[model samples]
Target: MAQNIIHLVNVSKNYNGTEALRNINLYIRKNEFLTLLGPSGCGKTTTLRIIGGFEAPDGGEVLFNGVNITSVPPYKRRVNTVFQKYALFPHLNVFENIAFGLKIKKMDKKLIAEKVHNILGLVNLSGFEQREIDSLSGGQQQRVAIARALVNEPEVLLLDEPLGALDLKLRQEMQIELKNMQQRLGITFVYVTHDQEEALSMSDTIVVMKEGSIQQIGSPIDIYNEPKNSFVADFIGESNIVSGIMLRDYLVKFAETTFECVDHGFKENEPVDVVIRPEDIQVVPAAESKLQGEVSAVTFKGVHYEMIVQNNSTRWKIQSTAMAPVGAKVGLQILPEAIHIMKKVTVK
Candidate 1:
């Protein structure tokens, strides 16, 4: 079993009378790439700050390897942080930026050079050691920031949306690169980001946060396939969420139609939320479909078409390879395994 490297036990934080993080309980496994994922003001960054010792929590404890580190100063912790801004020195070359930490520690000159060269190679910046910070591109600067944090050889690395400043194409490329680097280093990574795709693509485990609380924590596939609530279903990916009722085991009613599903365990006739991924819904002939609808809109989305189908008063977003012309009557075929049910939540 994997050991827990970090834990937040009933951690809470407040700012100016408003709650920022409410009773957050989180565990990060050793050598795992974990992401704290949510939108702005959702307290994801606050949680990261708490872990990094930048901000002391108003309540609860921060634990590292079962030891309480709530009072430990940031400099004393075995962790390093890379922020959205690279914070590289404009006058320093890449080699100096990466070696700064080691130099501060008064390490031997030879060891600093070896460590700097090794990390530069890890971030694919081997020959760029002599390059000035301003000369590097946004992606390269971000890599330098990561390399600086990593060159210290911290046990855990905290990243606060390090790729937020990069362009889309560069950000995507860096996502894969960072994941590979984390695996190669075999160190714990606690990453914070609001981008759902970025979190889903790179994390070994994702902690979904909303309004100062955690909504769900699971593997990317588990979170996508079995969202615990409507918010999680809607936040992690494009989902067709609708009000429904559990009529019985493996049976549900939505859109005024009863359908067979693979989920069970809800009370009979319990009000619930139903989620169907856009890609799971297939477009079929009206006669063969489980439900009939009119194609309201169609968009080309590179790999597939993003289409909106209206059945009565309910609208569904679907991803399909087969395009249906707007205003055409169509049928939406939903498989039993594709229908997911969750207990309904009352919106404030």
Candidate 2:
């Protein structure tokens, strides 16, 4: 059984009357890469800070390995954090920066040296020990910051947008590297980021938060394919959310057309939101399409093509393998598996 390394029970945080997190109950499994994903102003970072002991919750308790550590100070917790800015000391070299933590714990010089060397190698910075901090590229400096955090052997490592500063290519590379390191070390990683692709690519469990509330918690595939709500479906990937009426258990009506879907459990004539991912759409010859539309615009995105199709005044974004020229009559076909119907939430 996977151990629950960290548990938050009825956790709520408030700042001057503004609710930052509302009754958050979460259990982080041992060695699992849990990602708290959302856009800006979401409670992802707030929750991470609370878990790291950087911020205290106004209510509830935090348990680490079944031991209550709600009131524990930052230094007392077995957690390390990597911020967006590489917080390395400008005056210290790479080696001394990593050794600073171990030295404070009063570890012997020989042990510190050995540990630092191993970590440097692990982070692929074996020969840059004596190099100046400012001499490294953005990616290298970021790796050093990660090395500093991991060197302490913390049970949980909290990373808040660690790769946010790197370029696109570097970010992709680091994502794989970080996952590999996490698996090899068997340390739980709690990552906070607004990038949906990052969360989907690396996380074992993704907790989608919004406006101080938990929206959904599920695996990458589940969040991408079967979003719990309209916000989740739209936020996790490129989804076209259309208003639909449930006509039957496996059927919904959209855009004056009744279509078959896989979603069940809905009353007849219930208002719902149908989510169809762009990649799930198939474009056929106009005469062969179930839904006919004219291609409004087309843009080549290197590997695949992106096209905008228009039916009346309603527009739909389609990504397909077969490149369709602009002004062409195209038939848009969405498979039954691609249709995800969610009950519309009525706002007061």
The residue pairs in collision within model 2 are none
Error of 1 at 243 (Å): 1.0
Candidate 2: worst-modelled 10 consecutive residues by lDDT:
312-321
Q: Candidate 2's C-alpha lDDT?
A: 0.91
Cα lDDT for residue 218, candidate 2: 95
Candidate 1 C-alpha lDDT tens digits along 184-257: 88989999998899999999999999999999999999998888998988999999999999999999999988
Top-TM-score candidate index: 2
Q: Write the per-residue lDDT of candidate 2 for residues 60-83, one digit (tens) a residue.
A: 999999999998999999999997
In candidate 2 the C-alpha lDDT for residue 66 amounts to 98
Model 2, residue 143: displacement in angstroms?
1.5
